[model samples]
Target: MAPQSNKQWTVNGTSGFDALKFNENAPIPKLGDKDVLVRFHGASLNYRDLIIPKGQYPFPQRDGVVPASDGSGTVEEVGGQVTRFKKGDEVVTLFNQGHLGGSLNPTINETGVGGVIDGTLRQYGKFDEQGLVKKPKNLNFLEASTLSCAGLTAWNGLYGLESRALKQGDWVLTQGTGGVSIFALQFAKSAGATVIATTSSAAKAETLKKLGADHVINYKEDTNWGETARKLTPDQLGVHHVLEVGGPTTMAQSLKAIKIDGVISIIGFLGGVKGDQPTFLDCLTNICTVRGVLVGSRLMFEDMNRAVEANNIKPVVDEKVFSLEEVREAYEYMWAQKHFGKLCIRID
Candidate 1:
């Protein structure tokens, strides 16, 4: 492929809430040592994308910083010393730009791809080759786009802790049918752990079952849904793990549902930020552990792709592909939460 100019969305400073406008003046970024220039095929929207436009998360110093954390594309160019990826390689950019391996560090945590740095919602994106992972062969660009952030969050939340042990025949609980929870369901089932999933809609219960949920709970019908969760686990030991995406409001219920010495992975704040905090008595009674999860590293991304390839699992994507010009509509659709899976944008 020939070298080409870049096209991107620009958020005008005055109207922070306004839609991003196309800007031709944006310069195509130059590839540095160990860098790869990717011509993005598709990108996925996330809650973070909504936060950035409202200035909840400020953009980095780079001009015209596009706002999407996850995407997949074909490598268009690579700089000298780039070994892991090459031109024409299909890859996904890790959300954390340079955090490749080892334990998380403050330095590595400072920068991310889509927030505080230029993101993937563009016709082209550039990053260090270390930040890219080969897209799983089973996934198309749109499906792979959801993996970098959401998929990795689920993986890291379930497996990241050094102490928590998730074994075959164990039971895990996931709240809602959001991206992370859905990924957790698939991963837990693949690992031989039975999954109990929760959904607000009874209609979505069948879909959750189809995704391999061992038991599905309509949280709306059962106000005491935690008890329902306990009944689903083997020997009534309660679930071995809980993907705690519901934050404070549901934390107590999650604690109630987990078995003694169970692990709770805290990944989101969907269920309001303020509530009656859990007491030490509750912790002592349940012997539960809660771990905070940030989106994972590039190394985790590679491992996830390996698992995806090995299992031949395909991500569920309820996509509404929009041209670059219809970016605002795409954002609106995601905000409405009407879609069953990820919403994608076509960069071409």
Candidate 2:
């Protein structure tokens, strides 16, 4: 039976984590002809989830929007016309519902969940049949929750480029141990590519190595860690793919770390907005392609799930699982960068 009311976290008319007001009686919308009613079991956090409530995200966020894009759930009820999913199937949310395949554009960007529309920080959500994909058979809901954003972004960065996709023996450079970087490290290794990861602490470096990073560079000790990473590659030509998440502060080094005609997937700006930033001249000097990545299409998400299942790539989630009421605490923890891998919320 469809639930009479939904329990959820909504963006109250305020800023910051304090704005996440929990409502136990929000109405569950009626399903459209092609819609399915989902009972979410888990949801994961991303950097954007922190900034969106604070009015810091660049996208157009709706008033009172449910505030998480990554969620895993079971189809509890399906509309009569829905064909892709049945009532008992396990599914994961698609970050951009309209993006089925091909390159991203404004239309697809506007379809971003948790921003332009209501999202999954709730017990029940109604989605078009196309908005969710089947979860990997080997992964439970918690592990699958990490995929919609971070996992897919990493997959897109590594394999979205048809002509320059990650290949066997290629060297991949990943920054820090954030969700995307960790996924990149794991995915690259699965594809038989060598991975060089960067982190500030020795403890994290050890963790990175255990995750299959061929070499872990301590950027604090070796300020020129990019050059260090480059030299580790054959003939010192530099890494084939650079996951550039650090933005302004790290771009210069990323330039130094790339080979001629290499690819730098610009993923985020976690390293502060103000800094001595690199310019286009540096890109010319490095002779690399800097592509801005904003998650990926649903097709790519499906492809990534296949890879995750085939390679048994379990996502690294933090040990402390937060309850729905603890969403604010989860946000604060992510803001402090205190947790390793992805932080998730149990939707029960």
Candidate 3:
């Protein structure tokens, strides 16, 4: 068999991302007993990708590392033992490829896509069949690309609330208009929950309302946004679920905006690294449950796709398409927080 050729963006030893033009000179990514080879169509960026080069989340064995954990494409080949998918099926990679579900394993945590292992940022990437889910038929490649990491985090954070289920007419609060927060709004609305979405831009607040947010708060205008969130919910009981993406800096306010025993999903660190520690005393007083969420597993990814398919949920994609060569600029745009939604790189 002839070897395949592919273009990949690689960060060599924490320097910078550059085009690494290479022939797939190695074996055609021979599937493990249960793996599949996907030809990537699109990939979306997360804040973690921007922090990699700065050593915030350092990869010890960094050579040939492609930095993106979210992508969707078609399966070109599959292992002999693979049964979930066949050739030419559309699929996306699960964020934590090795960890199937439940409590995180140290070994599984150590080897994650785009971090310890090479990720889906390349034109061709391989993963265990268990880590791949059929893309929702309603979504195109760009929309499907946003789901692996951000979508799962929002789903797990909101729906995974153990204390109380998010019923219709209940209110859910999201901190910003980033990928996860935007997904939170879409999902909350689809689940018949009202969304009180907050953003720094009034323009974005309007956009949020269009996306079915019941109320939008300009956090920049209202410094005490927590009180505003409480006012939006019924009888000052506060929101049922707070999609708490702003860690530490906004944790106290998130606590204030939740109903007694409401769930707060702490998902991101965008509000300055190493802010003041959360006051657990206040959290206890409010009887709020703070759930620390990493991106979810393969099972959650499949379940989320089901929900997306059933609800016909469309991801709010801030399209800034880049070729493989423009990888650095893509990262820069995401870091600048200029994009309203996911920043995608087309790899075909």
Better of 2 and 3 by lDDT: 2
**Superposed Cα deviation of residue 219, candidate 1 (Å):** 1.0
Candidate 2: C-alpha lDDT: 0.92
lDDT of 2 by residue, 267-338 (tens): 999987896898888888788899999999999999999999999999999998999878888889888888
TM-scores of all predicted structures:
0.93, 0.98, 0.93
Q: Write the per-residue lDDT of candidate 1 for residues 189-299, one digit (tens) a residue.
A: 889998999899877899999989989989888978888899777777799889988888888889879998888888887776786868768778788887788888887
Model 1: lDDT equals: 0.81
Candidate 2 worst ten-residue window by lDDT: 11-20
lDDT head-to-head 1 vs 2, winner: 2
Model 2 scores a TM of 0.98
**Candidate of highest TM-score:** 2
Compare the candidates by lDDT and give the number of the best one: 2
Which pairs of residues have clashing backbones in candidate 3? none
Model-by-model lDDT, in order?
A: 0.81, 0.92, 0.81
User: Model 3: per-residue lDDT, tens digit, 259-307?
Assistant: 9878988898788667576677888898888888888777777778898
